[model samples]
Target chain A: MNSITSNVFGPAKSINVARVLLCLEEVGAEYELVHMDLFQAKEQKSPEHLARNPFGLVPALQDGDLVLFEARAIAKYVLRKYKTEQADLLREGDPEEAAMVDVWTEVEAHQYHQALRLIMLECFLNPTLRGLPTNQAVVDEAVEKTKKVLEIYEARLSEHRYLAGDFFSFADLNHFASTFYIVDATPYGSLLDSYPRVKAWWEDLMSRPSFKKISANMTTK
Target chain B: MNSITSNVFGPAKSINVARVLLCLEEVGAEYELVHMDLFQAKEQKSPEHLARNPFGLVPALQDGDLVLFEARAIAKYVLRKYKTEQADLLREGDPEEAAMVDVWTEVEAHQYHQALRLIMLECFLNPTLRGLPTNQAVVDEAVEKTKKVLEIYEARLSEHRYLAGDFFSFADLNHFASTFYIVDATPYGSLLDSYPRVKAWWEDLMSRPSFKKISANMTTK
Candidate 1:
């Protein structure tokens, strides 16, 4: 067990940090959480943190001598290294099913997250960070863009139980953290209610014990 | 072999399509090309195309009963299904190395591509697609962002031969198509001249036979 002690660095409130934490929880893997003060101290920009991730981003994982960054990539490393028969995060060894997982995961990364983050940045984080009011125009435009992305999700969920066809994989997990912020931590939570199937899918993902645990640990600033 | 016949749908001229095509060539995999007219006809918006990818995005791939979209996902599928002993595109068996590969891959997807695509859209694609003049302001902003990204790449490349540390994996392959468009198809091509390490890395990747083959097949609209 000592051989597998991994340290994850980032503030618990960070959406990206929540992403990896959820993966760790799902895999039932034990890791040391080194919370960096991203907002107050700006520790993420420090030399120590930058050495772990050149970009100075959050949720970098250090497993023994192998240091890794990118929340999704760290999640992949966690899933691959820690073998759990009950955990189906990566759906390891299943080529076609896994490819489908990759498809939706990429969709969430490239399409959904980009639009949703804009909303979170403008409507939620901006007000908190800058001590300024939320920008309604920016948030509205983001909401409109996200609605279009979710319409596709609604269509897909209308047929399948999850993003990658009935099975719960990283595809759903990839969207878990940010969507949590959008629906729970931000003003745009109601936007999801309009898309029934998408709403149901979100509800289902939120119900997972793994996500529940991580959500509980999130420190609201 | 006919049972495994795969078809890729998108205009040969598209950067996304070029990504999947490059992966296929690298894996020495045989696949059918199904060109969807993105311009003039706007065939990608048709229902037939939407069934393949609900987002109505190009570079959707169909392999027998299984259909997949998202260029990176399709590329992953190609690497897995039609693997070559001569090349390890995914670095499949090495967990640490593979995780490193994924780190760089994510960086390209999340950081580099977004900024570079803005430049591609404003400086190159906009003029051709909409008969509009180049938007210098947008292009300049994107270029500045891209320069920051490439500075990190230049530093990384100064240490390692490739993005994911020395070996040319999917991490490198993932950036091949878009970087080509930036350096060749856009005016910002000369931007690489300042980053000698990045320029050398680009030249090295371009010399790969796989990339050379795909470059020849690309239809410049």
Candidate 2:
């Protein structure tokens, strides 16, 4: 009655979209990826897509009667519903361990992802994706912010293998998509070299079979 | 050995701090509210506080060996650890119901709080708290963004009593602190009146004894 292969819809190379895709791969969940053209068709803002996420974002999941959005939330749902070998990614049964995951996840969302998003929008997204010139001032501001956040991560990674103790949690996985783009498409990748531990942690994440698989699909499509 | 009275540290009247405080009250957890001055003494950046949260933000929770930050994360930790009648506030045992809670919780953080924060920072916080002039342009952009989000909330609220469902969940509870300050301190409060369901939802949240008690404590100190 259950198939790990789920139907997921969103644009390719989207950091948010890749999050859901990465999770599907991480759990060995079989899933069909449907890509929508955000630039040409403007499909995400379409009434149909809006119904799934009124915020008009992408990477909506459809499974039976359930429709979910928000990459992080959908990741959590997938983690909760699909208990594969990676079932303990959230440190589910342990309250203390789970709290660490939650704390770092919050940091990644509110601080790290935010800083990276601004840098992305001002650099590659604005200049390449939208035909707008790069805004060096905004890039500088975001880079400074990201540097501070990575400093904290560097110290944390110095002691813990992952964001949550020695085990990799959703917090570690959550950093995959956006940082992938940073390391691939932007000059901000250079900043990581200064943070040896954060650099190593990120290297480990990028090398994960799940992240590698999802990212490969992103470019091929 | 279990005292609902938990020790919470942070600046007063902060939306994040209030989230932790609100949850403590809702879950019937006994918590001691410790206020730090953000301005003047600028204690949040103090070395001691930085030890609790490497990021130096609050409200930080101290229970035995646990030192957790991020109001949403702390709120979840509080909910998980302290089981009162409100143990079900997270919809813990039911996957589908918890998914709804998780989805809206994501909305509150990434979308709703973000737009409202810009509006608050430009309209009131800068002028009143920082002695800086209000930036009407930023305020206009934030208000426009917030209106779209409220429109979505209006449609959702028309169908359900709360963000998650009929029963009050943390998703509903999470809206309390920020919306209170919006209605009380910012002109954006007027924006809510336009969306009856949204306004009604806010009213319901504000009327909660926990919220009222916390907000009261904010001004008293």
Candidate 3:
């Protein structure tokens, strides 16, 4: 058995780390999650960890010599590696559906992440860190911009059950991790409330057994 | 043989459209390119095109019932469908290499695009249409931001030939498309000259027969 070692410096409360843990649950994979203390600047910036990830980010995965960073990439790798029976998780039998899923994943990585990062930086990181100030103008612009992007999702979910059509794929899970984090922190939480279809979709996704397991794991730390 | 249709708008000089064309060449795939007259504002915002892409973006691909937008997604599809011998365009063999490629592509789509778009809007799009005068400060800031990013690439390429190591993958291609376009318009054109390894790598890529073919096609239109 090729064992995988996941080194995560983030708290279980971190949405980025939760994205990976949720992916493991979806794939039913058993792996070690080595928790690193971000407060102490322990494992993440350590020379060993930096060797694995030059960026010194958390949620780095190691399978023998195959060490990878990036939460989305690691999530996709887990899905591809473990979920042979779960067609909806990674590869789709229908090319079109698969492409749609890819599109949503890209959206999650690009537009969704862009908005979410700005909000997170303002609400959490910026105040405590060495970056730009959590200015109201920047936050407002981010919220407005994010709402515009989410409107597209709102329209899509109005017609379909999931972000990638009917299938509750990892794509939906990925978006949920980031979106729910922003909603949890920002006043723009009501944005989803206005989009009933998206709200329902969120509720449905969070209710999934895999989501439950991952969410439980997140709170435990 | 399945027929594919790609909607390419803006001027023939558009960098985004060139990305798609380059992908087609890499995959050795044949497709019909439908040029949308951006001046007339005719084809891009047309109802049919809008149906394929809600964002009303150019370089949307259509294959039978499958309609795909987002240039990266379309390029990935073309590579998967037509490229017989997978050359690790996105680093196929090793998990780490693949993940690195994926991360760089994300960086390109997210961070690099953000900076480059600012430059483009100020330098090319706004100026060409006689809109607001170009913001020199914004342009300068963007160039600095983009150069910092290139420094990361330079550091990586100094140690390894391509973005994802020795292999010339789609990650390199993605960066090439974005950087080449920005360099064409910026005083930062000479910035690339500072990174000898990256310059050599890029020169080799630009000299590829496939790249040559695509560039020729791009100019003739």
Candidate 4:
């Protein structure tokens, strides 16, 4: 395990990849980004990359002998291995507080991320990446679902400063990469304004220097 | 922290709920089941229920003073709090092995579970719960996606006894509940048999006494 500088192989624009990068940045860990563009170059399906990640996903991390896929898993690995100042992302000592962090982390990924991904595909990716017209019906449905999830976030954020509690954790960090697109590049930026707490939460996330560095050129424009 | 017995609120038929029950059973943890049917009874939307989970979802957990939702989160809490012989489900001793478990756990949930959910909705829930006709189109797309994920599982299982490694872990456990429905109730039972390794892996999970106890009456019949 001499090679501590982990190699993160993923395209820069990928939200999941950006999440891994943000995690490393937050921990001040040294990492080299290996940009493998899955769509344009079809390099993800290459045999070498496939060897790294059987699913052929953009995010495959190599830390010495350990090669891992799934961006969140990689992030967790970083937090576990590196004892940086910000590495107490999961409340290492308290089980209940840690479980709360894990709870909201899953909620963000499973519910909020999926809904926002749908909206992004319809409103941003399809029209921009595939050169296809935006499907208003799909966007409308996604917006409805996103709003339902956001209302819950509003309630949670209104009480606590962050999703997990008074402290920021990976649960809060997980929201930034995807929701940033919704706030930055999509037609629904104003929706965040509807939930003031949620809006403030996003602003707080964007204010982080780690996220700012990772998302510097991440806008669709 | 004093009270160890947890109360899990969710319908008996829910896959996520069953997942939590299976984790509890695996650890031999004591829990009281409070059935809150989100669909038929609509108890999930009740003000009291919403207080537990603002997302208004079934599968809220009450353990002492802590209220947690998201079925996986509850399962993890049970694993963490209960130090039974089977509770080292995350490879607690090793960081590298633990990260592998987390990676595959996400794969099963995000990739395999989503596809299986869509297929179940089209082939089982829509027809059985809503009394609507099965949509072959949705099921077809979902089956295709599921097969792709299963291919990855087959490759992984060919090398190791479980998703994480030669030993069983939560990564393997996560697949049981949703996939059980697909193999038991849907028309796609034979699809699992297409991959011998995948079939054997599922057979091993199904044979577990913990899973068997929880899913005893959980059938479409």
Candidate 5:
């Protein structure tokens, strides 16, 4: 705890890294960000990186002796360990509220990210990383699917101030970083404009200090 | 609370539904299982069903006034509300242990399920659901990927009894149901036999009363 040895290993442009950084900001924790060149170096698949995460993915966290991978897990760790006086990100104490938070968080991971990732890869990474032309068919399909997922978000946001309920929790932050990247980094980002409530919710969450601080340090591409 | 209105809506053979049902059994909760024929009825996408789950997926839980979807979310809800006197399915009070649990649970959803599902669809569900032949190439690729994942599991289980430590938690149960299907219903089922530690851990978890009871009631096909 003295030295804040916990570090996040990944590129700043990574939505997953951005996800963890938002949680760290929410918990007001001091930690180091170790940048790995995911494209040029292919460092994530290196033996050194695989030791931290067997899946060879990034945003792995090293906290003391506990090494953890998976951005959601890392976020849960920060929210649990470095809990701030401001608000509980995971709603740890209230089981019911926490359960709701857990539902939306998983939904973000399973449902929302599923579609957004397709859009990102087809629209953003295809052009940025591989220098390939955007496949219109892929983008069109992804936009259609992502819009369906966001329609649910639009309905849920209409009912609750945030995804889980009236409060801002990790559920909202979970979607924030990914949505930021999908919208800003990808050409299909404009698809979000169709879902009025979802777009408004995105704007509201992005304006928060947690996202604002992280955004200052992140690169879209 | 009066009538135990928690109902899980999905086909009995579904891995996601099986995951939630296992948690319900661990909690010793009485719940209704509403079987929906995905091929014939297709009720999961019906207007009534979409009201509960926007993603139009099965394993949606309607508990009292709170309607929830996403199998992991429903599992969290069951663990929180219907908690039994036996042992906490989730390490509720211990933040560190719970964080570890969260990590593995997400791994089950993200890393393990990603590959396992591919194997299931290609090797198992194709023949059963669609009367299609197993795609050997896809199955081979998935088997290779899943073995890599299980290698990490084998290493971890060698050190600890379960994924998130010794105690039986949702982290273990989350894996139990999916793995039960993959091993029993797929060509790559024997692949698990190669990883001794993971196999032993899987067998140990399967032998638990919670799993034994759920397995008796589940329909694999």
Candidate 6:
């Protein structure tokens, strides 16, 4: 049995789960991705998983007696534990570069998450489950906001190769996950097409061996 | 000149600034707090302050040549730079304990920030500035969500003394700022009173020498 087990759900459909899986691939660590049945609410709310993650969320990682949840945290832990030359790929040695990584990661958590989640809720969750009226105004507002954030990325990518400077860090991975979702779901998906720098950035990220490896094996339910 | 200089606006009554101040006090670092004239739109949007924080937010920190704008990030850096006993406070010695600290800090960033910001906007910002009708429904929903989050904290506090366990770390300080605002502004304020464990937990936090120093010196705009 693998020492590290990642508990995930909703198929390979979830960007959050993809984050940890991709990080594991980046570290070249042997781990098992355990798919949880979200429909049955079985794996998530199970007593064992609850002990690992009180929130009953997927993408929880367990290593021996240490249990960790939150995709970014797990990614950082894996990188630190494995201590690869790819350290610069996730975090830099310099404090300034590290701070830049923190900044973009926060950007992912706050702005990107905010815009992407709203678009997802409007497009999929509300339409199928919540029975809420679709507000074009809200959707437009989200698109505009997402465009503004992407413009920030576009400008940054114009100057640097990756989100956190010259290195292809997990910060890039974080944005890739959210932006991929945005392109799939939002009307503003075409906005990335206009930002040539950002388009190149995405293309380069998707070409990574780790991303390709994990994403290829992903099971979409 | 002091090593740290912070631009303050949006009222010294801001929980965000309070968090930074608490951290500065914890590290016993000398700083100059310049009150931004928020009413006149003087400090936040001023070219100088905007350079310090592109988001035009208050509590931007300048440490010599390296300037950081986010309050939480600044607080973490302050502790890291000044505290000799970092391992004890931040749980740095053991990977498991350190992971717990990191997880709770992420929780502060993800869950606590969302709930607090929503309540703040609904309770204060919309009604006061936007001339929108105070949406009790929005605020009530936020309160309910906050209650669930606090319930998690309550259970944790029942077993441990602080948010990250027995150690009185910055996790408590990070939460103190937001929770202080919630206690003052919401009916959920009374909810904390019911959780004797949480109440005891908070009391211990407030009694910290750092908390005392920061609270005493806070200038209310």
lDDT per residue (tens digit) for residues A1-221 in model 4: 24578899988889889888988888788899988877778999999999998888879999888899998888888877764555688775678888889899989877999889988888788888899998899889999998998998898898899989999898999988789888778988898889999998888888989888988859776
Top model by TM-score, which number? 4
DockQ of each: 0.84, 0.81, 0.47, 0.83, 0.72, 0.46
Q: What fraction of the native interface does candidate 5 get right in terms of contacts? A: 0.76
Model 5, A1-221: lDDT tens digits are: 33656889998778889889888888778889999998888999999999998889988998887789888888888888877657688886776788889889888887888888877787777887899988888778878888888888889999998989999998888887668777678666687788888888888988888888888776564
Per-residue lDDT of model 4, residues B63-137, tens digit only? 888999998888888877775565678775588898998998888877888888988888888887899998888
- Relative to the true structure, candidate 4 reaches a TM of 0.95
Q: What is the DockQ of candidate 3?
A: 0.47
Q: Write the per-residue lDDT of candidate 6 for residues B76-125, one digit (tens) a residue.
A: 66666565674245554455666677788878877876777678777766
Evaluated against the true structure, the overall lDDT of model 1 is 0.85
User: Candidate 2 overall Cα lDDT vs. reference?
Assistant: 0.83
TM-score of each: 0.94, 0.94, 0.84, 0.95, 0.94, 0.87
Tell me the native contact fraction for each prediction: 0.89, 0.76, 0.41, 0.87, 0.76, 0.24
Q: Could you tell which candidate, 1 or 3, scores higher by TM-score?
A: 1
Expressed as tens digits, the lDDT of each residue in B123-213 for candidate 2 is: 7788888899988998899889999889999999999989998988988888776677677777778999899998888878778888788
lDDT, residue B76, candidate 2? 90
Rank all candidate structures by their DockQ, best first, as comma-separated numbers: 1, 4, 2, 5, 3, 6
Identify the runs in model 5 with alpha carbons over 4 angstroms from their true place: A1-5, B1-5, B219-221
lDDT of 6 at B100: 74
- Tell me the TM-score of chain B in each candidate: 0.93, 0.93, 0.85, 0.95, 0.93, 0.84
- Residue A88's lDDT in candidate 5: 84
Highest DockQ model number = 1
- Provide the global lDDT of candidate 5 against the true structure: 0.83
The root-mean-square deviation over C-alpha atoms between each candidate and the true structure, in angstroms, is: 2.0, 2.1, 3.7, 1.8, 2.0, 3.4
Q: What DockQ does predicted model 2 obtain?
A: 0.81
Better of 2 and 3 by DockQ: 2
